[model samples]
Target chain A: MDIVIVVADAVRASVGPLGAAYALTAIGLNLHYGYTGLLNFGHVAFLMVGAYGTAVTVDQGGPFWLGILVGVIAAILLGLLFGLPTLRLRVDYLAIVTIAGGEVLRTVIRSGDKDSLTGGVFGITQFATTFFGANPFPEGEYGWGRLAFTERQLWVAVVAWSLVALATILLVLLVRSPWGRVLRSIREDEDAARSLGKNVFAYKLQSLVTGGVIAAFAGMIIAIERQSVHPDTYLPAGTFLAYAVLILGGTASRLGPVLGAVVYWFLFEFTDGFLRGAISAGWIPGASSRRPTSARSE
Target chain B: MPADAVFAAEAVTGSRKPDAILVVNGMHRSFGGLAAVDVGHLEVQRGVITALIGPNGAGKTTLFNLLTGFDRPDGGSSTFDGRPVTGLPPHRIARAGMIRTFQLTKALAKMSVLDNMMLAAPHQRGERIVYAPLRSAWRHQERDVEERAGSLLEKFGLADLRDDYAATLSGGQRKLLEMARVLMAEPKMVLLDEPMAGVNPALVESLLHHVRELRDEGLTVLFVEHDMDVVMGISDWVVCMGEGRVISEGRRRSWPPTKR
Candidate 1:
């Protein structure tokens, strides 16, 4: 196994478009959990809506920008749908509703009934022509061998990371202001904030909408990067992974999610690269790269 | 000690209603067939430290909850500063210049002592989600709020602990912080639910002084207490409740009537 190749792959995964998307999603989660004390267990629902909204709009003869707008609006409405009834009750209620909501949305999108609109279990593809057509990267390989990105990947990477930087800047400013002060106080104790003349419910709903919108943007980035919107991709596992990234980076701090996403993807790709290399060299007994695929297809 | 005698005595003291900061009439509340509070009539005068005293389950806390809009009354009306405030949400009531502290002392434990104080300042423009990301919009007002919070912290002897989380404060310090945080809102009336229930003996003197200073500064105070000495020391008037009714009320000098 070439140690250099494993490190290169790990570095590529950490700074790539996927890491950017994960960072964006976890940033939203930080706003929800770290700042507002909300338990949004099904954050992937926002990503799913974002991805599907853009894809369906584009598929139905809309402009790319319109698709992005539609995705954002869908996520806002979803946030309201999940937040309106539960935010006033208890924090745990939001958790249960969000988790259930994510699964339900995925199942509905992939079900046979929505096949005409959503492409059912197979999902949507080849919808990124507008996004890539506007890519400013030249038609060439962009870096060193195996550590390089094609022009298309570079375009997506630039856009995704820019979005991450913008989101982080916004959160940093917002959390340092008086508004952020109220949020932390609410996160500490709702009744205390209420007694001090703060509208607890309205603030909670606003936090939910803000985080949900950011997650939706993350979904758009993912769909744009992959040139597809797969229903199965927006699973409960995606939300759990975002949470892992959020916690790993440390909550309530700006840029923590970005760092966490990078570290998490580095380890993930490093292990995968190491294992694949080991298997190819026949270094591990009874272990084959082909074995995992066969089991997954079953 | 009959119900009529209680009512007769209440009516006599209730004559000073014209300048009362808070007035309640026939306020009632119950939980699962158990009447928690059923005050027939109560009035707290403006700019005086009044105490509500009772035994366990006597509904002192329930009355405070109802008055501050934490809990709704089954049937009744209340007016604060001559405005109808009945059935308003707690936040609205708080904005209307009535602030309250909890018996358990909700100090926003995870937040810094300074952040807790700054959070209570009313009319913060940056608290609005739209204005939050813009530093220039609320910056001036924020500085002003911080100055006010700083002064309050200094007054409460929490200036050094301003950056420390409320969780780091002792029980007595938390009680002090809660009181100071309440003042940050510039409340016209303050409701304290057992402000000294768990406070240390040394800190109790400071707490009493602060309550006295609040009244002297022209803010009306309504507090619940079980300690007669503390009550007698600070309260200008006292209302005694028993089994969900105000059993007796009297001027401070005449309270705790002596047996012949």
Candidate 2:
């Protein structure tokens, strides 16, 4: 493989729609684990609900805006459902319940019985034509060379990044206020915050709901960017990947997840491209010499 | 000054008790089969320094936990400032003007010293998420809180480390910071669990002075300690616990009770 192609792939991965989606996901995780110190290991549950909510809505003949609203509301409800009983118990309990909840939801969505509502294993597609129709960009390519995006991709990237910017601004403002102080205090020690007259349980619930809603929006963006929604896509690995991005950027800081997501995708794609190139060239012994799939597809 | 006069009255009569700021009746807390705190009756007078002293597992800390709403009493009721506060959540008890510090000293290690103090100030409008993102909504109140936190930190000899994380503070400094942080709420009463458990002698003196100052400024203090010197040095009244029961209570002047 050419080094130029590898570099281009990394560049595209860094700033493209995929990076924006992960940035949003990590930002939500930052709110949950970073500032609030909630042990939410099933963060992808929020994403799953967001995507499914929109897909089901649109599949049932609803408009795109209503689907987005339903998705956000669904995420809020999911947050509360997970938070209410376990948040009062212990952080580790929340972690257990959430990861279980995420896996449970994925299994349920992909099960054969839920086919009519969730499309089962096949997933949903073409539900986002309305989303693309709202794209303001004229039909043309945007950006340069391998980094360029078609009109639809450009529209998704623009909207996703704009939402990310808004979320960051909100976080910066919120974290600087007295409210943020209480969250940081709670993160430090719940008993201390409670002794200081903060409703620790209430704050934790609020943080969960807020972060879950953000994750839902991120999920909706992922579906729209791909113009598809699949149950298998909202896996626990995505949550762990989001955690990696959050830690890489710097937890508890507003812009950390965004920067982390960009760098994360750049490295992810660059390494993938390089390794695949090497594998096809038989650089590593005993590795199956396979075709360069991207080369053939392009 | 009134507490001083009350002390004099109590010293002379040995029976003139002031109004109780906190009253617990038949308070009982048990862990599995072991009764941790089983006090029959206890009263902490308003605007005075009181010390709770006991051996290990004597239930002094457990009693503190029950009174401050950190732990529930298996059977009993408590009233603070004439209002029944039984089984109320910890935050409600705190908002009702009763604050507590842990034996371990929760100083919000990751936050700045100033943030730790400012976080304890109650009723900030910005604590509401709706108001949090809008600076104009709570900026003025925030400024006032910052000023108050600043003074409290200065009083605790922590002003120089305002921007530093609380985690960077020494153990004694964390004790001081915890004490100062609780004061930001201007609580009418404070429950301190082992405030001097691991303090240097020099810092212990300053801590005793601060506890005394709290009483002088019209705040009630209930502290648990194993240190007899601290208990005898500052407490206006002393309550001794044995096997989860308050076995003895008296004025500080006659605390040893003249040997039977």
Please report the candidate that would top DockQ against the real structure: 2
User: Which parts of model 1 have CA positions greater than 4 angstroms off?
Assistant: A112-115, A288-291, A294-298, B1-16, B257-260
Clashes of each: 0, 0
lDDT tens digits by residue: candidate 1, B168-226: 99999999999999999999999999999988899999999999999879898999999
Fnat score for model 2: 0.96
DockQ of each: 0.84, 0.89
lDDT by residue (A1-298, candidate 1, tens digit) is 8989999989998999989999999999999999999999999999999999999999888998999999999999999999998998889999999999889989988885445799898788878799999989889999999899999999999999999999999999989988898889889999999999999999999999999999999999989888888888887988999999999999998889999999999988888878888888888888864734411121
User: Candidate 1 at residue B45, lDDT?
Assistant: 78
TM-score (C-alpha, index-matched) for candidate 1: 0.95
- Model 1 steric clash total: 0
- Identify the candidate with maximal TM-score: 2
State residue A273's C-alpha deviation in candidate 2, in Å: 0.9
Report the C-alpha displacement of residue B73, candidate 1, in angstroms. 2.3
Q: Write the per-residue lDDT of candidate 2 for residues B1-260, one digit (tens) a residue.
A: 64464454333211335687888888899999998988777777888887888789999888888888888899999999999999999999999999999999898989999888889898999999999998999989989999999988889899999999999999999999999988998899999999998999999999999999999899999999889999889988877778898777777787674321
Q: What DockQ class does candidate 2 belong to?
A: high
